[model samples]
Target: MLERLFESTLWNSRFIVILAVVFGLIGAVILFAVASIDIIVTAKYVVATYLSGTHPENFHQDVIGGIIGAVDLYLIGVVMLLFAFGLYELFISEIDVAKESEHDETQLLAIHSLDQLKDKISKVIVMVLVVGFFQKVGYTQYSGALDMLYLALSITAVSVGLYFLGKVGK
Candidate 1:
């Protein structure tokens, strides 16, 4: 009887993972708030620039980079959200609210297994990386054809990698 009881206790300890879900949710909220603030600040900058009627050198590119950075933050927030939801569903239980919703077919937070969760988070992370790369490239000055060629080659490599990732499981 003691052995059975100990085994039961050990098995039930898996609920401790709910702490992970809680922390993940909190982190996601913070990230989303930061991303929102970033976009709002970027918008304010754009409006001020427009009203001032001054096209300083690289102003447009600067604005674009700001927007892309904001997008990267938003994507990271999304990744956190997906991680939280996926962990909760995978380790705890299926989300009943999602199943009951009419939009169940289109739900993004659904995860039936660890692999699905990994796939979802990994894809968003790649997107965030791509956005970050673009933001950095936007500020970089290309001094020669060689620099541009290098940039093109870097983009091609990223594209190929993304293509292969997509082709996985097919």
Candidate 2:
């Protein structure tokens, strides 16, 4: 009886994962809010600049950079969401509402195994990295032909990696 009680307590300890699920969801919400605010601020900047009839030297680049930064944040938020949902399903219980949803979008959050969760989170992380790479490249100045060639090669590498990433599990 003592051994059975100990085993039962050990198994119930998995509920500790609820802490991670709750915090992960909160983090995702914060990220999404911050990204949305960044987009709004960028829009205001654009409108104010055009209305003033004075275009800063790097106006376009700045706007693009802001948008890209927000996109990066949004992607990270998605990763957090997936992490939360996957953990909850794996350790706690399947989300009943998601299972009953008629929309296909709910399928995206459905995770049956730890490997599937990792793959989903990793894909979003790669996308976030790609966005961050472009955001930095947009602000950088190339000094010579070699620099430009390196940039081209880096872009090609990213593209090829993405192509193979898409092929996985298919």
Candidate 3:
């Protein structure tokens, strides 16, 4: 009887993780909303610039940067969603919708293990970082050959990093 009581108590504790996972889902939803807003605002900026009829210096770069920033936000939101769903599926239960879907094997939300979840999130995060770096470099001005060389080196480094990230688990 004592062993039964202990087993029951331990099993019940699994539900505690549900609270954290729900909060994470909510956070991901909020991030997605914010990213949507950001895209809308960027569109407005582009439209206003177009209406002004004056090609300001760096206008193209600014618009590109804004778009990239929005993409970064979206990628971050994706990471959050993957984290939440991964935790839920790992600790709680399989997602019914994913399980019933015809394309269950191809869906991003079909996380079968913690390692898969981590890999998915890491790839998205690396993409976000790469976009962020590009957004910054878009506005950077190089006054000398050395500065241009440094920029080239930075690009090479980022490419190498991405290559290694892709090669993981292989």
Q: Which candidate is the best by TM-score?
A: 2
Q: In terms of TM-score, how similar is model 3 to the real structure? A: 0.90
Candidate 1, residue 106: how far the Cα is off, in Å: 4.9
Clashes of each: 0, 0, 0
TM-scores of the models, in the given order?
A: 0.92, 0.98, 0.90
Residue range 90-137, candidate 3, lDDT tens digits? 888888878788884647788888789989998999999999999999
Rank ordering of all candidates by TM-score, starting from the highest: 2, 1, 3
Which regions in candidate 2 have their CA more than 4 angstroms from the true location? Answer: none
Model 2 Cα displacement at 90 (Å)? Answer: 0.2
TM-score of candidate 1 against the unseen true structure:
0.92
Error of 3 at 99 (Å): 1.4
Error of 2 at 77 (Å): 0.2
User: What tens-digit string does per-residue lDDT give for candidate 2 at 35-62?
Assistant: 9999999999999999999999999999
Better of 2 and 3 by lDDT: 2
What is the Cα-based lDDT of residue 20 in candidate 3? 72
- Return model 1's CA RMSD, one decimal: 1.5
Instruction: Highest lDDT: give the candidate number.
Output: 2
- Tens-digit lDDT track of model 1 for 109-136: 8898899999989999998998888889
